[model samples]
Target: MDLQLKDLKGIGPQMLHILRNNGIWKPYDLLLNIPKSYEDFSITSIEKWHHKETITCLGHITSELKLIRGYKKDRVHFQAKIYNHTIDIIVFGRNYLIKEFKKNDCVLIKGTYDLYKNSIVASTISRQDKQIEIKPHYRIEGIHDLKLTHIMKDLFESQTLPIYENLPKELLDERKLMSRREAFYQLHLPQTFEAIDEAKRRLKYEEAFFMHLNMKKDEKIETRAPKPYDIHQVRALIEKIPYTLTLDQKEAVNDIFRDFKKPFTFERLIQGDVGSGKTMVALLAAYAIVTAKEQVAVMAPTELLARQHYQYFKTYLKDVNIALLTRKTKDKDMMKHMIFSHQYDIVIGTHALIEEDVLFKQLGLVVIDEQHKFGVSTREKLIEKGKHKDVLYLTATPIPRTLAMLTYGYAKISLMKEKPKRREAILTKYITKQTIDDMYSMMHSALIRKEHIFLVVPAITSDKVTDNIETVYQEIIQEFPHAPIFMLHGKLSSDDQDRMMENFITTPGSILLSTTMIEVGIDIPTATLIGIYAAENFGLAQLHQLRGRVGRGNLASFCYLISTKEDVERLDMLVQSDDGFKLAEFDLIERGPGDFIGHLQSGYLDFKYLDILEDEEIFLTAKEDLEKIMNQPDFNSNPKYRYLYKTYTKQT
Candidate 1:
């Protein structure tokens, strides 16, 4: 709607100032607002109302009234009959209400009831019969409950002005969901709490429906015919590995193979936990595709990760002609020329690989590590640079299957549930104050074993005493006087970070202090202990990832969750289970989807009013319904679809 808050009636200069500051420029912006909470201001009987609680009562003021005029003000005493009980009312210094209180006048008295005095300390006496209110509270800084409602009520009353009709009556009827206008109305000015909840649900459903539509990417689509390759060759590569592949990793490899047999372009996601072997799966797939006379582009989100992948590729397949293309790589033109001329079999790099000048010859498979970080558009651009033979995504963050299906609609998924046999499951514990000395003792023992330590703080520097990189570094240096101590965070230069990481990896009995920025894809197999000082500041998935840096080797590992806050459910959940997928679901449900979505897919899923966790059922229903409808041949011409489609286009 073109209806701005400026056009709405009863919004004077003060209201306009508040509205503009809060980003509510238009009528629909108000629709996007969600009430913080609701309060009950309904009229109640004397017996039902509690002491010191503000309640409203509809009662008749008796003819008998006493007025005591003091020097400064006047005190009025009166009797009101409510629910057949005679309750005394004392109105002090509110002389203006005296005129409104007439004999036998049925007035609404709002005040706190006193049980012992058997009277109400009246604040307001109104002749109007006040209806019961389930007050919807919006916490705008300068706007009170009444002022906010006045603006909302005015917008609702302006019926000729418009809000976008997002869904059709047929869809509403099919789902038994409230109409957009009705949902907005009830949500702003609720009739009953049940109706308010229903309104919230339907609004979330509509937003999620639009979100799914936004993420849909089939506008320019084509598939490739599968090129046959020798299965025995890929198997021999697998058998040549020093250790047997985990069952889940083997199955993931097989899933990629099956996708290769298909006639369509391959879009698959290899999901696993922190120590799970997703990279190995990608390596195998890349080898298979490159051996079939096609090049593979293995992309990582960061330069460090890309370099790590290139080193792994070289270590495993020494004969493979792999090129590393990055911003820091020397001779950019030469690298680009080599890549364009197909002089290399496999190319690994950061987003620098997607520059227009860098082209791949017979690019068959695109393997993206931490795929969520690249998003769909960057991924599509990379695929456009290739032959579109197949694409594989690797991620450590695990989404539930239902959520995965709803989110990555077109991409098939294979999960790596098992870590390697040599890697022991990390023993998790909640660090207590009493265990402080024991922790240092364990560190001393780990020092004897030549293992390193990871001290993860919540920040680079902090106002707090100890839970930061700088302070923790100082403390650790004091404890281990001769040991090598290194620090890493985002503020440091990338080259400095690489140097620090090298020192950390090579130096034995070392301690590295860092922030959550280290949670990406750091492989420190010799590190046996990771202690998160402010454990409560991190989520379940993140905690799992930080703990993953250790326990990568055969030696035992421990994750110390240390925090001042006791009995944190998320922290406890971390200690109880090691599975990343279950922790992701728990974090989504308990803490809300904001952090989870923000960490991975930041810009793509910009939801204004929907809480994906709370509205999961509604979202899934919307997903299923929209999926079926969009598959129809004439869905584009449908009125609701067209309306929303136009609105979405305008927004873009």
Candidate 2:
């Protein structure tokens, strides 16, 4: 079945636009948009209401609707006594509920019974008869609820939907996987909890299996000759360097060098914490590639990070011809020569280097920093440059085990467990507004010592919040009147962001006020003090990464999380601890990796009911199933496996 809707019999441009907006371009995708949860408002009476102390009710409005003036937009002032119960509902939201009200019609109202001023009040209200069953909500887009429901209803009712028959009948019978028709029908309209669970297990397993198969097949294809790369040279370079490589870096670099000597291509992911020497390992790999008389390239997710890496390499390899290819740095002809002519031995930049026009000069190795920030297509493009040369990926937030197996399980896995020796741990503190004066005084003393400071605000501009960059910049400038201050945010022009960063990088006793935009690459060793305002609003992994920015260069660094007392509870985990691993685990638990997937969430695996963090067991099982399926020569022969194939192909 064609993924494009133009191939569908009756899909017009208007409907196609709506479907595309909702990320439903194909029939298989529609099948995967499983209902998040069901809304059951079928209780007959208060006595029959499940006895759960709270329940949702949908019924006809038998009484007159009354409206009263609200004190605020959130405060609702309306009274309607339902037929079955004596409770009256009070709705709010600037009369948002009034639009839904149809005189003498049914409505769905949801709230717990509460006695207010001697009268019962149902706070949150909805339409009773209009309550949708098995509703699925995506991350909002140009599409709306009405649009999606209409499409889904049409697709369900239409026999024009081509049945996906990718799976073989024997496989479906062997594994007892549901058929294509049954799975699609049940997934959308699940009748029981058991059915939902089984369908999810089947779908998740199939996704992991397909991803693994592709990687395995890709790895199996031999791309380059076994170019002898001497580990001794890289080892000697490491030894001569002033700073010793961390144990993780040593092992990773060694593994990389050994793999480079192999006949097959090297595809590896280096999982390390922030401040761990991933860049050094990447440099060692690049050195090996250059020694082989082949070109090497390193791609960073951001221009700032790419420039930083280029500078690091340029300083270390004076003899090597290094070039930077970012949006700001390279001219068109220079970029073309760097790729087509292979003019530079090592080209470093962002996605601009991965274009079709960018050719390689005997491209031998590709290093991707912060690999999670990139998509599979981008990685594949970079890999294509190397003539099947080795690819090394470095990431601070190492893909979680379940995700790694789903995404890169077929590739080799290496862990960088420790930071460099004698590394000073970041001292983290959470301070309230009342204690901010004390915090400032301490920072002032640090500044008096001629030390640099980093002030991280939640926003670049003063919009949508009481505490913003403008407010924080003004307050900090006033407090440290003697010290210079600069600000940066994502919204600023790239030149402005770079200029501000450069100013802070060159000058001492200067406080750089910026947003989380600086979280990835800008490194200022002299900045011993980092003040993060509204820290509770940031996720734990992000908070850890931001804190990691200050603790670089073995100095005793401090990170201040300035928030209100009310916000302290939300940030207790950060103040009480400083382990990135533990923090990551906690972060995953608190926030279940919502939109970290490809396409920021949509094209990514958006698990409806499954929490990738909490349901670790399910993911582990999926991985095991994937491994089992990959080993089988003819997976199509298995009934269960065939069903999975059918579902996947239908969506793709």
Report every candidate's CA lDDT. Answer: 0.80, 0.69
RMSD of each: 5.1, 9.0
Residues 1-652 of candidate 1 have per-residue lDDT tens digits of 4666777777778888888899887777877786889876577765678877787888898856678798987888899988888999988897666665677988878888898898998886666444646767899887777667777777778685576567867778898889888888898888899998888778887887777676554323357778576777888888889999999998998898888887777678888988888888899998888778889998899888898899989999888899998879999998888887888999999998888988887898889898888867788788888756587888888876645655555577898878788888889888864565667777888888889998888988878635788777777778788877889899999899888988888899888888887787888778898888878787787888888888988888988888867756668888889888888898777666665656454343456666555566777787688778778787768665787556445544
Model 2: per-residue Cα lDDT over 147-258, one tens digit each:
5555656676776676665544554565567766666666665556566667766565455445444444444347567877665776677677788777777788778777
- Candidate 2's error at 232, in angstroms? 2.1
Q: Provide the lDDT at 331 for model 1.
A: 92
Among all windows of 10 consecutive residues in model 2, the one with the lowest summed lDDT is 595-604
Model 1 has an lDDT value of 0.80
Worst 10 residues of 1 by lDDT: 213-222
- Which TM-score value belongs to model 1? 0.79
Number of colliding residue pairs in each model = 0, 16
Off by over 4 Å in 2: 1-222, 327-343, 355-357, 371-382, 404-413, 595-604, 608-611, 618-652
